[model samples]
Target: MTFDPTLFLPDDLLERIRERAPIHDRENTFPEQDLAELRAAGYLSILVPTERGGAGLSLEQAAILQQRLATASPATALAINMHLVWTGVAKVFSDRGVPGLEFVQDGAVAGDVFAFGISEAGNDLVLFGSDTEATPQGDGAYSFTGTKIFTSLAPVWTKLGLHGLDTTSPDGPKLVFAFIDRTDAVTTSDDWDTLGMRATQSRTTRIDGAVAAAEHVVRRIDPGPGADPIIFGIFSVFELLLASVYTGVARRALDLAVQTAQKRTSKKTGLAYSQDPDIRWRIADMSLAYEALPPQIAALARDVDEQADHGALWFTLLSGTKHRAVTMAKHVVDQAVLTAGGGAYFSSNELSRLYRDVLAGMFHPSDPESAHSAAASALLGPLQG
Candidate 1:
């Protein structure tokens, strides 16, 4: 009980749950009391494994407790950064014994294991593909009829990781998962209204027949070298927890752009754009990129947890620390929404939902084409360490 990564955010509760990010992005809602106060203060099992109680962190102490819970809600740290990458790929698929290893109740989270069912239903959300079809049945149980789109938590999750295709062993696709105890086998359609993390209900799950067991289906066994870049897999700790939840929504849009330039007054030099010097160099220039993106993504997640089985050099150091912390959290949340002027897009500004939850770490899964082809094969190696 004593591993304090800012105890998952406590300094008057991270500026009071970052003032509830503009009413959970204007009711596209689902912070659910900031994820039930970050899973009732266990801080969502920080990499769930110390023989399954967890806090066995070390993806550089779970990227400093996911950059202190994305400083305070980068859309609930990108909807709980895929529950620390589905519990670190379910603790390396339960130490390689692999069959399902279903331990989410290690202390009942009730939701989280976060989304990415690999898009379907007339797919084309920018083409990094998969179809998800699974239907196998003849007494080993299977029935995952697809349509599962974006799926960031079909109205609250309880662990999920599904990618189907199995109408009874018609092979090559089977990673199944579910603890969904009937949302009637999953159904959600309102295509996650987008343009940003908008409270990240990132929806669309629709399964009709989500049955499980064939030991709840767990088949992603990459001992390595599918040319190694899965950013070293579990999406490189979700691209360093989506660059520390977009550097905690660019440090809460640089503290609401330095409290709206010290409470406005500048109708052209009527002064007090916090005594402008180019709005105090864009609010002290996003506090030096929020104090240097949590120590360079905690030293590249401690060199990928000290070479966790060197999976292609921890997928080229978690894809060059998520391409330099999502290109420095997109120039520190677009210069904290232009030092929050034009009332930072008034939906009752909170730097307009930290300028839309810091652009969900700019095309997450550490975009920029797998961080420049894993930094050009880790500075050009004959790499496979």
Candidate 2:
């Protein structure tokens, strides 16, 4: 992934999305229109490789476009997170790496989506969790019965990648990536209606007696790290992507305030609210925060592109960006409310819609507390011999 500064988001498509954002939010429907537009624009298959029949867009471009999407509707961007995450994993499995890696390479190239069943009811699904179960079954297949909470995009996924704990092994918990065909499993409880990301469709996914053969499962040559790096990496991606979404929401808030002020004038002063000094400064400050966010995240994307390894460099930049994004959310939109004044409080205004949407960023798993800890660990000098 190259760090190209000239990169910009698909503005026209995003503007159309912005127009329909209110309806999507109001009706609590998945951003079907937004997803269609993204798919039509070749965004749904972004992580898929060029040889495989997908865009294979660079990290930088993906980030730019995702952020743009967030500005229109963060929930829509979130719904696609699982798709993109699994797409990356599929590519890795297809690529030449680890022992017995030759398998799935062709399928990956051909394009297949996988949804990870990682988190259980009690497990830290937000962070990578160690939840797996396996028992040998007839015909070299095994039954997997595990409860996974917060399974985003599970409703729309066909391939199920269950991260299970293989208890048969004496070596602690052997984390295995089990692949199950969608036709084999059932969503015990598929009802998903949420408070914030109303349209994300993040339902509780269940796989009872789903059988996946040994060949379908792909474990690392050595089971390198304890957990799937992709899942852990998702937290990092969530931070950046959600941050962009939050920033976009804030941008919309500012836009709404400006538009509201333009249409209304002070009856007492005979002047438009936009012309008022107080209003000018508020808009100025809001714009300043919005301008500051994209560059900060763009810089982080560049750093990630340079450092492929999810080591110190990636951790530092990614966690730091999450922290910065949360701060920016509080600063930009909170103040934008003041700028919009009394009008924004009314449910009729777009500002009210953005007000709730922008706040969703703060509640993501990458809260300031955990992010700060990661940042501090990164800053701490490696212990000298």
Highest TM-score among the candidates is held by which one?
2
The C-alpha RMSD of each candidate to the native structure, in angstroms, is 17.7, 4.4
Q: What is the C-alpha lDDT of each candidate?
A: 0.63, 0.62
Whole-model lDDT for model 2 versus the true structure?
0.62
- Minimum summed lDDT over a 10-residue window in model 1 is located at 222-231
lDDT of 2 by residue, 15-39 (tens): 7877876676777666767766666
Off by over 4 Å in 1: 1-150, 153-186, 191-201, 204-208, 211-216, 219-239, 248-282, 292-305, 308-339, 347-353, 356-385
